[model samples]
Target: MPGALAAVSDPALRAAFREWILRVADDELVIGHRHSEWTGFGPDLESDVAMSSIAQEEIGHARAFYEQIAADEGSDVDRLAFDRAPAEYRHAALLERPNGGWEFSILRLLLYEQFEAARLGLLAASGQEPVASLARTLVREERYHSLFARTWLERLARADAEGRARVQAALDSAWPDALGLFEATPADGVLRAAGILGEAPEAQRPAWEEAVRPVLQGCGLSIPAGPAREGGRRGLHGPEFEEMLAQMTEVWRSDPEARW
Candidate 1:
């Protein structure tokens, strides 16, 4: 709403850009909530604090994106975030899945951070206004997230046979949904055609793979052979997402008019 999107005069282009922004915001918000679940339950004290900090940052990022859309629509970030129904969300299914365990959470974080970094890079080069500048600023914060995940991933993978096995199992389980992060939509095509987006969402997959594959392989993890899980981008989520959404929006739903 900082007039960043005003130059995109075409209604179709604006709609597509808004959808893309919502997708990014939703992804961050859902994953941030998932990460927050570990606040008091992390395997160790440092990890607990670190995950909490990461959760705050992710949610903050979500707010930054949501603010743009909300401002454009004459709404508020809290309304855009907490007022939406489960099926209205556009986050990848990978983010909504249960944290499972420390290893699972770490592996999930590793995958997501890599994907986010790549996507942000494309956004930075998109020649868009405030959004591109915002992407550049967000990239600096994301570096710590990547580093945290990588450090923990390596330690867990090399800890022992059981640790390595656990990490591997996590990778196998998460890979399919991780791939779903790049599931393409008409919005992606629209953005690409408008020159607002440098690459379609699906086209960013290889770059994400290139970034994550080496780090994962270095940790002795094998990439899983599975098809990408789809639907989240289209607002089709599983029951787990329903439950999470119910919990996430409970307070807001209880009193939508109340300021938090």
Candidate 2:
């Protein structure tokens, strides 16, 4: 994204940079939190450990990226994290939507982790260095994250009718909104012009769809063809997001200025 950030001196470009960063932040933060809900609740021991690691990696990633941006603002990362109002969060509605069960969470991970892998690949190739370097490193971790999800997917795919039913339904439920992950903003053109994005951010959606469709199909699942849900990028969220935001910020928002 070095090329994409080359023009960040421009106010519009800078704002775009911040917005895209926030969106990425929101994605990691919420999904990490959602996955964390399974800390001790996974169906078995190995899965419990694996899911916990994934959750930690996500929150850790969010913190690292937030630190990079926070330094420029003369503030710390946590404020931008737990201190924000739910309305201020920019994660996709899909992520904030409650995890119905273990299989549901795994399905969500299977879909989003693949999308994240591609996004990180794009960032790694972006002309930016420090952030690009961060993205490259995170992608390596994400490869393992994705492999874990795929392992579960293959096992769950071959499970009994009821297990397959639950997993398949979760996939269908998460598919369309997964597209929300790529909702474009004015920042998109800036990122593109700055050479941070390989192309217009919107251009990646169809390719992402094509890239992952086979995985779902091979599982005997079909993409949930529905109207695209939007607004998470702009901090617009749904009822589920509202509940999640309140619970997430409960601790930090109580005394935001206090040093932890």
Candidate 3:
């Protein structure tokens, strides 16, 4: 990793470059797995369908990012995803947080999709053609995700007294880690200096906050303020990830060498 950083002229820029890209990939995998639990069990038929689509898209996005890195390193994406230990995962605490209620899950999806959109937009213009191209294609899928998040957020927030409160509470709980998405790393400076990415975490973070703030406000929600609880980018995550990992790899682990 340090060798990759040394390739960049600046320390901070390279760290930032790696930080965002890795964070993006980890967040998607964790959240996608979380959401996949609702495949046949959401609040209603339409909702189940919508949430399943979101879950598939998120996992698909993660596969795209993970496969790229795997291809670069001659590794296997399936092993990277399903066979890894929890501590090895780089996803955020927020992604591993349990889905309490359907409304809460919807709210979580809303916030996550928003963050994913901005993250991909920045990546799409990184001047790293291959990575940037992946980001561009991801944006196409993320657009659908945003539309789903917005529809559910607005509907739930305005539906009834209980619905409004539930969505609001979900927002309050998720806000802290939403900011955690901006956590920086040692490579931030090198990415920019090497022209591998567009902006450092220091620069991209506030812009992301500003951009996301309006969306929250427009949805009648409050922005969270706190020292962001981090560690997701550093391969630190919540306990829920362990449970999720077991479930995700259960069938695959049953017969390691068996072919379908």
Question: Estimated TM-score per prediction?
Answer: 0.97, 0.92, 0.87
Question: 1-260, model 1: which lDDT tens digit per residue?
Answer: 36356667889889888888899899999999999999999999999999999999999999998987877678888899988778899999999999998999999999999999988888789887788889899999999999999999999998999999999999998999999999999998898887778887778888889889999999888998979999999999999989988898888889999976
Q: What is the C-alpha lDDT profile of model 2 across 15-107, one tens digit per residue?
A: 777777677777998999998888888899888888989999999988877776676676678988877777878888788889887778877
Candidate RMSDs in Å, in order, are: 1.2, 2.6, 3.7
Clashes of 1: 0
Q: Candidate 1 vs candidate 2: which has greater TM-score? A: 1
Q: Measured by TM-score, how close is model 1 to the native structure?
A: 0.97
- Could you arrange the candidates by TM-score from highest to lowest? 1, 2, 3
Rank ordering of all candidates by lDDT, starting from the highest: 1, 2, 3
Clashing pairs in 1: none
> What local distance difference test score does each model get?
0.90, 0.79, 0.74
* Stronger candidate by lDDT (2 vs 3): 2
TM-score of 2: 0.92
